[model samples]
Target: MLRELEKAEQKWGGANKAIDQWLNNRRNLLVHYCRIAGLPPYENGNSLPSVDNVRSFCEMLVDYVSEGHFEVYNQVVSACEKHGQTSKAVAQQLLPKINDTTDAALDFNDKYTEAADDKVLMQLDSDLSRLGDAMETRFQLEDQLLEVLHTRHS
Candidate 1:
């Protein structure tokens, strides 16, 4: 996920102000995810992620998704309107799938925000895995939107 994000930045980092900010948000959210999931350099799985870490991840997760819906999607749609039908069609197709991912993210946030018991902690790894998959899908959809828009708008 992190590697994909870096590649995305390389490809579309400065294409526009909104995309630049959205991708930066993605970077921060993925870093927080890595820390909580104990992936890579954060892999100190001798213990569960600290409560503070989980809380922070949930906060970042919500904020990231909020920006996508409230800011990025609108910007993408507006850009597409100034272009061709293909871009408009692409945006229409992709945005709904992205919304599904948002639901998954919000579900994860709600589940873990107040989690403090062994039972809840026991689900963290699996939940993270599911959320990771959803996020990967969402990122691909978002990039497709950006690619289509940038091709025409740029």
Candidate 2:
């Protein structure tokens, strides 16, 4: 469990770094574009990025989603197995949620180019909101499983 936790932590850290880099690049791109175009960099509570911006965001987003599916979740499943928890059943429970997240991510990727429009941006917001809620549920499920493992082992 500890090893798996360590691996997951490392993957999460990598994702964090990637997000940071993407954000910095994105900021620079927007600033440069605005300067060249003689327009102020867009601000005013806009949530979604432009098509190019969303494309860049989706690159890192894909990375995170891939890690979540193959690395982090796999580690969690392995932890459950090593500790004799409901590895199989828990994985079954998690599969659809993971699939939902992955599918949503793919949808975002596909629509990212079209997301500059207000309607598309609104859809992106809705998709992202769902993704956020799904991730929270995953976190809670992992916490619950960890508590059970700790209680049994400790």
Candidate 3:
């Protein structure tokens, strides 16, 4: 997973540094999540994920979402327009799914914002699972947009 993200950064980083950085942040967030969920190396241990790790993940999650919505999406739209492509149609088609993903992400953030206790963190397993699915959907949508708006033009 980490290597795949690194390759994506190498491929697309120069085109948009902000998106590259956000991808790197997402990689880190996934690592932290894996540790918390005991997926691999941490699976041998019985310890819960540290609050600091969860906190960092939550913060990065919000930043990634914000950058995607406010910066990266705008850049793609602008690029499509500059290239004489009909960005409006594409944006309109994608808006609903994007908005749904945003809502899910924000809800995840809100749920974890005050999770300082172990009980709260434990309860987050289900929400986090749902978040992982939402993020996958969001990434696929964003990648599709990039393919049309950035890759083709480039």
Tens digits of per-residue lDDT, candidate 3, 1-154, equal 5565666667677787777777777777778767766777668365777777777778888988888888878887777777764665676577578779988888878877777677877766788788878877887776667667665678
Model 3: residues >4 Å from true position, as ranges? 1-7
Write down the TM-score of every candidate.
0.95, 0.52, 0.83
- Candidate 1 stretches with Cα past 4 Å from truth are none
The candidate with the higher TM-score, 1 or 2, is: 1
lDDT of 2 by residue, 127-150 (tens): 655644654454445444434434
How do the candidates rank by TM-score, highest first? 1, 3, 2
Tens-place lDDT digits, model 1, residues 1-154: 8888888899888887888988998999998898888888889757888777888999999999999899988988988977878888889999989999998899999988988765787789999999999999999988888888777888
What ranking of all candidate models by lDDT puts the best one first? 1, 3, 2
Q: Which has the greatest lDDT?
A: 1
Write down the RMSD of all candidates, one decimal each. 1.1, 9.1, 2.3
Tell me the TM-score of model 2: 0.52
Model 1 scores worst on lDDT over the 10 consecutive residues at 114-123
